[model samples]
Target: MAIVKVDNLSVQFAAKGGIKTAVAGASFALEQGETFSLIGASGCGKSTILRVLAGLQRDWKGDVELMGNRITAGKRFQGALRREVQMVFQDPYASLHPNHTIWRTLAEPLKIHGESEIEARVAEALEQVGLPSEAAKRYPHQLSGGQRQRVAIARALLLRPKILLLDEPTSALDMSVQAEILNLLNRLKQLHGMTYLLVSHDADVIAHMSDRAAFMANGVIERSFDRAALVNGEHRMAHA
Candidate 1:
C-alpha cells in the first residue's frame, strides 16, 4: 500500500515582490518500503515538498497524507504521527545545535517519546550509524563533517520511523562521505522496512538510491521515472 500520498499540493511564500509559489499542484505517492526521490535543479520546490512532509512547512495548500492520515496546514504533529515520520536535513552542521552534545541530540527524541533505557538506545543508534559510542560525548563542533551527519541519521532512526524525509541529506559532505551516508541509509531502510521520500539535485544520487523518481521543475512535477528509466539514465538532463 502507498504509505505517502500528495494530491494537488502547493506552497506559497510572501516574497518581497508578491506571493511566490514554491510548489504548485505537485503530487506523488510512495509505497511501503520504497525509496522515492525528487530530482531537479536548485529552487525547484523539491525540498519544499519534503519540508511539508516533515511538518516544517505547514502553511501550504493541497492534500498530504502519510501512513493513511491526511495532513492539513497548521496541524501540529504529535504522538504516533511524530514518531512514525522523521526528517534528516541537508546541512548536517546547520541542522544540529552547536551547543548540544551528540548524546543529547540523539537522546532528546527518545526522551520526548518516553522511550526507555535512554543510554542503551543512544548507544545502539550511534552504533547502527557506524559511529563509536564515544563520539556521542562530543559536541557537533568537535566532530568531523561526516561524523555530524552520521549523528543526524542516528537521531532520525531512534524513533524507528516508518517514513524518512531526506532533504539533500549528503549535499554538504564530501563525495566519499556522501557514498558512505547513502549506503548507511539504504542499509538502515532495509533493516527497518521503512519507506523514504528523498529530495536531491544530483541525478546519480537519485538514480542510485531511488526505486522510482519524479523530475520536478518550476513548481510542478513534470514527470516520473521507474527503475528501468533510472537505470537507462533517462532522468539525467540539464535541469536534473
Candidate 2:
C-alpha cells in the first residue's frame, strides 16, 4: 500500500483581480521506504505542493492519504498520527528558533506530546543525524550551516516519522554542505524506515537521492520516471 497518496489535488488563491491556481489536479503516490522527488524550475509550485501535503495549507480539493488514512485539511489528528509525518524546510536557520538551544528545540515536540523521556529521545535523535551529544547544548547560531541542517533532521527523527517531507532541504547551503546533508538524509532513512518526498529544482540532487522522479509544471505533475532514467536525462521526454 502507498504510504502517501494524492489524487487530483488542486490549490488556488484569490487575487485582487482574479483567481490564481497554483496547483492543478496534481496526483502521485509514494510507497513505504521509497525516496520520491518532485523536480521543476522555480515558481513551478514544488514548495506549494509540499506545504499542502504537510497540512500547512488548506483551501484545496483532493484526497491525501498517509498510510491508508485520509488527511483532512485544518483538522487535528491524534499526536501519534501527527507525529507520523514530519517536514524539514528549505532554510534550516529560519526553521530553528534563535533563542532556544538545540536541546530545548529538539525537546519541544516531545514535551508537547507529553513524552517524559525527552533527554534519551533527544540524545538518540542527535546521534541518528550524525551529531554529537554536545550539539544539544549549542544555540542554532553557534553551529555551521551543515550542523544546523543536521539538527533540523535530528528534530524530525525524534518523532520517528514514517514519512518525511523535505522542501528544498539543501538549497541554502554550499555544494559541500549540501552533499553532507544529503548523505545524512540517506543514512537517516535507512536507520528509521522513513519515506521521503523530496522537493527540489536541482536535477543533480534529485538524481542522486531519489528512486523515482516526478516533474511538476504550473502546479501539476506532468510525469514520473525511474531514477535511472532521470539521471540519464531520458525522463525529460518532451514536455507539453
Candidate 3:
C-alpha cells in the first residue's frame, strides 16, 4: 500500500525580482516499508520536495496524502499527524541545539506529545542508534559528526514515526561515517518496518538505500527507474 502520495505538486519562492519555481508539477508515491529516493544536482528541487513533505515549506500548490489522509498545503502538521512522520535533516550540527544536552533534545519531543516513559524511550532510542547511554549527557559539540547524526536519528525515532523523510542524510559526513549511518538506517528500517523517502545527490547512496529512485531537474521529475539500474549506471537522466 502507498503510504505517501504527492500529485501535481508545485512550489514557488519569491526571489529578488520575481517568483522562482522550485518544484513544478512533481508527482510521486512511496509504498509502505519501501525506500524511495530523489536524486539530482544542486538547486534542482529535490530538497524542496522533502521540505514540503515534512510540512516545513508552505505556499505551495499540490495534493499530498499520507496514509490516506490529505495534508493541507501551507499548514504545519500537528498532534497525531506530526507524530506519524519525522524528518532527519542534512546537517546534524545545524539541526541540533548546541546548548541542549542530547537527553534534553530527545525528551522535548516526548514532552510535546504528552507521552509517558520519556526516560526509557530516550535511552532506548540511544541504544537503537548505537550510542552509549552516557552520550546523552554531552552537548552537540562534544560528539563526533557521526555521533551527532546518530543522536539526530535517535531523536527522530523516539516518536516511533512510521515515515521518515531524509534530506541528504549523510551528505555532510565523511565516507566511513556515511557507511555506518547507512547501515544503521537499513537495520532500523527492517527492525521497525518503516517507510523512507530519501533525497540525495549521491547515486551510490541512492543505490544502497532505495528500492526505486526518481531523477529530477528544473523543478520536475524527468525519469525514474529501479535501484538495480541505477546501481549499474544503466539509468540516465533526461537532463544529463
Candidate 4:
C-alpha cells in the first residue's frame, strides 16, 4: 500500500479581491521508502501541500491518507498519525527555538510522548545526526548553518516517524553545506526505511534525491518525471 495518497486536494485562502486557490485539485502518492519530490517556481503551492500533510494546515478539501488511514479535514492528527509523520523546514534558524538549549529542544518531544531515558535518547539523537553529545548544551544560535539543520533533522527523526515532509530543507544553507545535509538525509532515510515528500525549486537537488518528481505551476501539477528521466536530466529542461 502507498504510504501517502492525496486525491483531488485543494486549498484556498481569503484574499482582498477574492478567495485565492493556493492548491487546486492536486494529486499524488508516495510508496514506502520512496523519495518523491515536488519541484516548481515559488508561489506554485508546493509548501502549502506539505503543510496540509503535516497537519499544520487543516482547512483543506480532498481525500487524504497516510499509512493506510484516512485523514479528515480540520482535525488534528491523533494516535499513531501524530507520531508517524514529521516535517523539516527550509530554514533551520527559523524552525528552532533560539531561547531553548539543544538538550531542552530535543528532550521536550520525547517527554511529551512519555518516553523514558530522555537523556540517552537526546544524546543518541544528536549522535545519529553526527553532532557531538556536548553540542546538546548549546543553543541554536551557537551552531553553524549546517549544524542547525542537522539538529532540525535530528528532532524530526526522534519520533521515529515513517514519513518525512521536507520543505526545501537545504535551500537556506551554503552550497557545500547543502550537499552534506542532503547526503545525510538520504542516508538517514535509507537507514530508517522512511518515505519522503520533498519540495524544492532546484533541479539538481531533485535529480540527486528523488525517485520521482512532479512539476507544479499555478497551483496545479503539470507533469511528472521518473527516476530514469531525472537521471537523464529531462526534468531540468522542463524546469528551466
Task: Using TM-score, give the best candidate's number.
Answer: 4
Indicate whether candidate 2 or candidate 4 has the larger lDDT: 4
lDDT (Cα) of model 4: 0.95
lDDT of 3 by residue, 1-240 (tens): 789999999999999999999999999999999999888778989888888888888778989998888899868886677888899999999999999999999999999889999889998999999999999899999999999999999998988889999998999999999999999999999999999999887767887888988888889998898867877764444324
List where candidate 1 sits over 4 angstroms from the true fold: 238-240
Clash pairs (backbone) in predicted model 1: none
Candidate 3 wrong stretches, greater than 4 Å:
236-240
| Weakest lDDT window of 10 consecutive positions for candidate 1 | 231-240
lDDT leaderboard ranking: 4, 1, 3, 2
Candidate 1 vs. truth: CA RMSD? Answer: 1.1
Q: Where does candidate 4 have its weakest 10-residue lDDT segment?
A: 231-240
Per-residue lDDT of model 1, residues 43-137, tens digit only: 88988888888888889998888899988799887668888999999999998999999988888888888989999999999999999999988
Residue 216 C-alpha lDDT in model 4: 92
Per-model TM-score, in order, reads 0.97, 0.94, 0.96, 0.99
Measured with C-alpha atoms, the lDDT of residue 212 in candidate 2 is 95
Writing each residue's lDDT as its tens digit, candidate 2 over 103-209 gives: 99999998987888899999988887888999999999999988899999888887778989999999999999899899989987997789999987777788789
Model 4 residue 155 CA deviation (Å) reads 0.4
Q: Give Cα distance to truth, residue 63, candidate 1, Å.
A: 1.4
User: What C-alpha lDDT does candidate 2 achieve relative to the native structure?
Assistant: 0.86
The deviation in Å at residue 146 for candidate 1 is 0.9
